[model samples]
Target: MTRRRLFVGLMVVALIVCMSTTLFGAASVRRYAYSASNPGGVWYTMCGGIVKLLQEKLPSNIRVDMIASGGSVLNTRRLASGEADLTMAYSTHLWECWNGEGIMKGRPNDNPRIMFEIYKSDHYFVTLANSGIKSMKDLEGKRVVLGPPGSGSSDNSRFTLRTLGINAIESELAFGDAAQALAEGKVHAMGMSGSPAAGLVEVAATRDIYIIPFTDEELDKIVSAGPFFSKGVMPANTYQGQTKDVPVFMFTVYQVASKNVPADDVYEMMKVCFSPEGKEYLGAVHPYWKTMKNDPELVKALGIPYHPGAERFWREQEQKK
Candidate 1:
């Protein structure tokens, strides 16, 4: 071959190699980004575990990145802006964002969708076991940590407290740090709403304080306000010092994704989250994972409509019925 032809042949081979590399890279890797407000919280831990499981179960090209965020509101906004592929949020806030209610009062997000309900967050107004704080009414004059301003706990705490005619002042702190603050007696009591045996609660309990259970009257007041709030009982043994089921208003925690995420991705994500292996993964991540067993009825309880992909999953399940 002439020198020029040889050079041209080399150039053509280089072009083919470059094109093949680009296609291989695109096909070999799937990138997913996630963020959680309280990285040390149970939800983040469980979600992180799932992400890890995905890495193990998914093709080698799939990569998942977890980012720490400022809880529900921030996560919701991120999802709407297409900054996050998935996030954890409370069902009530999900609705408020969807309908532009409450703290989401002025800004509204209509593009988020529920992938599945994760667990129940039973609101607890806990004081030091020895603090002489017995009920919601008892905390009226005490200094209370309301939880961080935009967190699911903060929203539910304010609503629950208001429902009971108790107007305790709120001190805001990030979720992971709240328990430590409580242990140091920086705040009279901290509001915990979510699953019974969550890591946060475990941290609080290990501090040698008691969990003050809410009264039926207080629980009734919250439920009466809206279906977003419901009665959830925390069995006594859920905590070390507790002995009876503590009745309180509970909120649903859900896994939500942007409206733009593909249906197949959401479907596969849900299946992975609820699978037997997923359950085991959750159990290892946090005791709260024990609360994540798949419940079909939970889809109906979500405050907002399911994502189209989620809806398809439920519809297919229904078709079998």
Candidate 2:
């Protein structure tokens, strides 16, 4: 409880320290800030990969600076507030922000526009194997990191917990911090969502960590709660452990852009994404991209209007093929 309270109290301090972030751009160039997640997570790495690609491929007049942020919910706020030009956010987070619900409830942000769906984030409820936390029901009364404050992690955690009738002592710690705490046995489980997520492989390398799969009953409760939730799976061998697939709740992670961004810049960005070489280039950046292609269905799934620039690029791609 001390570590949980301490981490909670540090929110103020973390905010102050996290206020400053790395930005890479030229003074004379047309630059935009992209909000992403912490170092250990996939979003951070994916954003970093795109940052390098944009810097190298886009015309010198444009620059994209990256901000390692809390996670999806915060990224949505940044986009809606004109603080960022583009970001990748969970589909549920985007849906909630657009309709004035979820974490940003009552303050509807109608500005978020979908670019494309990237991959699905499966919720992984991780606890030390010896803890005997074999399922979501086992989490009751235990200390858990319910994901970072204003993140999709926390958003999912709260709803799932409410549905399951379980309330673990929760803290909103970022991926890296929570992983550290878990390693020290400060928390019983760390709830997170990501593809090729952090901590799984690392922690499993030394200690035995078990991933608690969401039961069908829990998945039905989640999906019945809203259209945003879907069933997902963690393939066999995704992490070193028992070899069978695990059932999990799933949602889309997508690239989002604002209606305010200059259309030409957005078009150029989209064009580069599906360019002949880019099609092959992206798969190498993150293994998740292996399944993503220039598919119109990916955009349609988000259920939001697209930025004109992004729409034009996709339309052009369709016309060509």
Top TM-score hit: 2
Candidate 1 wrong stretches, greater than 4 Å = 1-5, 12-16, 23-28, 196-206, 290-303, 315-321
lDDT of 2 by residue, 169-255 (tens): 988887778877887799999887875676556777778777788878888888889556788888878877747788888887888
lDDT of each: 0.71, 0.79
Report each candidate's C-alpha RMSD, comma-separated, in the order given: 3.1, 14.0
How many clashing pairs per prediction, in order?
A: 8, 0
Tens digits of lDDT, candidate 1, 1-321: 699999999999999999999999897676777757564345566667767876676545656678877667677767766788888887777777777776568778776887776777777766677777776778887888766655666767777777777878778787667767766767788876655425456664566556676667766777888557787777766666677777777777777878877777777766666678877887777766667643556656554667777877767767978
lDDT of 1 at 314: 68
Give me the displacement of residue 180 in model 1, in angstroms: 1.6
Position 204, candidate 1: lDDT: 48
The pairs that clash in candidate 2 are none
Model 1 clash pairs are: 29-61, 36-69, 37-69, 37-71, 121-194, 122-194, 129-210, 236-244
* TM-score per candidate: 0.84, 0.87
